[model samples]
Target: MKLYEYEAKEIASRYGIPVPRGKLARTPDEAYIVASELGSTVIKAQVLVGGRGLAGGVKIAQTPWEAREAAFKLLESSIRGVKVNIVLVEEKICVSRELYLSLTIDRAMRKPVFLVSEMGGVEIEDLARKYPGKVHRIHVDPEVGYSDYMSRIALSALNLPWSSLSELSSIMKSMYRIMVEYDAELVEFNPLAYSCEGKLIALDAKIIIDDNSLPRHPDLQELYGRELTSYEKKARELGFSYVELDGDIGVISNGAGLTMATMDSILFYGGKPANFLDIGGGASRERVREAVKLMLNHPRTRVLLVNIFGGITRCDEVALGIIEALKEVSQVKPIVVRMLGTNEEEGRRILLEQGISVFVEMDDAVKTAVNLTLK
Candidate 1:
């Protein structure tokens, strides 16, 4: 789940990170009161998305009245299709430099990677593309964890003084710890800057925790449910893309193109797909398991068809998820898997051992699943 900027900053402050004084306001009056206290505040729409500045979701207010006006204009607005019901009123910081720092899941390496850059803020994407060499990254092993020396080495590339390096390194350590502790897929401090007071402060922050790990951290739940159908909502909760259909066969794949093709093939083979689900790239066993369970327990689904051509995803992990769902779910349905890509042989072996057939051809799998649904 993606935490709003203010929510992410709240977590960061608890870890001893410096952030501008801010208050979350639900109304223009609340924003006015906050701005009166802070003086010269920045009003930002609290939406779970990026490019807020470009979308006019952000405004700099020189006075409390301006803050109120900005809040009144932004509240009840929409950014990238998401409604903004809250705003963050914060004291603007005067900084000498803009920098970027983050730790995120490295699926291919199966570890967390730290990214730091001199060019930061909203334009960081363009900067990185234009000058790729400025942005530096290091893959951190989960077992070894983060090391002070490693951070310092990476920091030196930016040509920083020893004092600055020590401070930034400490902050990086905290970020790394937060990512692991919170089961976060991404923890970021974009435009991590140095104020006039010589203190490094976070101007913006983002955190995305794994939805599958949500049960363990009930305290972090804040986002409300979307107005979607039962299966669509369930798919969102499971961190996958899904669309309900009036059919008897459930389709699962890793990408949109592949999923569309799977559904088309199902139709071609005379099978009506009950739903379209994409488990996403580099899906873990738990994620796959959740997807499988969703399909099997679905009332409209009579058969489950899984077609995975893994690139970042490991077929063994996919097989493990399928097996876990079959073992745990009470209702059993006809499941046919067409597995390929990394660890294919091992995945087939695992599925075969569980008395489940794994198909190598998509046509065969689709035909079999469609035929099974007729029974």
Candidate 2:
């Protein structure tokens, strides 16, 4: 689960990290009010996705009028297909230098890694590729946890002034604590700026909590619930996983691994997936109906692709669900289905009877779905 920038900064502030004063506004008038209070502010669209600046979602407003104008333009637009419903009006900072710092779970090493870079405000991946020597990484031992020594090792690599080391180390330790306490998968402070006043402050914040840890933290779960899209909320209620994408093809699969593979195949064949919907194990006919209905409801979905590699989930049962769904839903969007394993022949027969084409090959099914979108 990802928290909005304002939400992440709020969490960071609670952990003794310095952040520019900010308030979230839902309307141009509210943005004006917040901007007036701050005098000079940065109007930022509050979206979960990145590259907001490049998307024209982030702007500088020197006055209330400018703030209102920025808010109007942002709130009326979409970033990466996500509607900007709220904007963060924050006090603009005077920066002397920008730095990057973050803590993230390293799956391969099975430990949390702390990353720092002298350069900031750019994509870390690009930074590492262009100036590999500037980016530093340290793997924190879970058993011993983050220590002042480890903090020194990470910060020293940045070659920051000795005078800034103490405070920067404190901030790094605080961020580590927040990551651990909140069960976060990532806590990033991009462009952690050194202000003209010689103070290090977090200029941008991002926090992603582990989805599996939500049950243990009701407060974080509530925060996440508020940010979920309608389809995502419904998917959770129906015991499935869904992620919206910018594309015309809606993909439904029985397992996460297969679902991802199907999406990749679609892209490889010059297609884009509209969403990722995993029906998971033991999906009932009702669940399948719900899934299909959900996919058809997406305005961007030009076609639907169902790929099932049944093991515990019987292929015939999946076929029945799809048939029932088509009978109930009003949309006439094309659907391509691929079913293999466990009563595959029976499933194919059932689908054939309903005038639905079923494919035994995954690539063929993906290709058909992609072709339908072109029509």
User: Which candidate wins on lDDT?
Assistant: 2
User: What RMSD, rounded to one decimal, does every model reach?
Assistant: 9.3, 2.8
Worst 10 residues of 2 by lDDT: 151-160
Question: Which segments of candidate 1 are over 4 A away from where they belong?
Answer: 123-127, 221-231, 234-260, 263-275, 278-375
Tell me the whole-model lDDT of each prediction, alpha carbons only: 0.87, 0.88
Across residues 224-314, which tens digit of lDDT does each residue of candidate 2 receive?
Answer: 6566678788887888888878899999998898899999999999999998999987767788888988898778889999998877777
Q: For residues 1-375, write the lDDT of model 1, one tens digit per residue.
A: 888898899989998888999999999999999999999999999887778889989999999999999999999689877778999999989988777888888788888988778777845578678889988888888888989886786667545667787777788888988998899999988878876766789999999888778788887754534435667988888788888888999999989999989999999988899888998888889999999999999998889999998887788999999999999999978789998888999999999998889999999999999999887
The per-prediction tally of clashing pairs is 0, 0
Could you give me the TM-score of model 2 versus the true structure? 0.87
User: TM-scores across all candidates?
Assistant: 0.66, 0.87
Write down the worst ten-residue block by lDDT for model 1.
Answer: 221-230
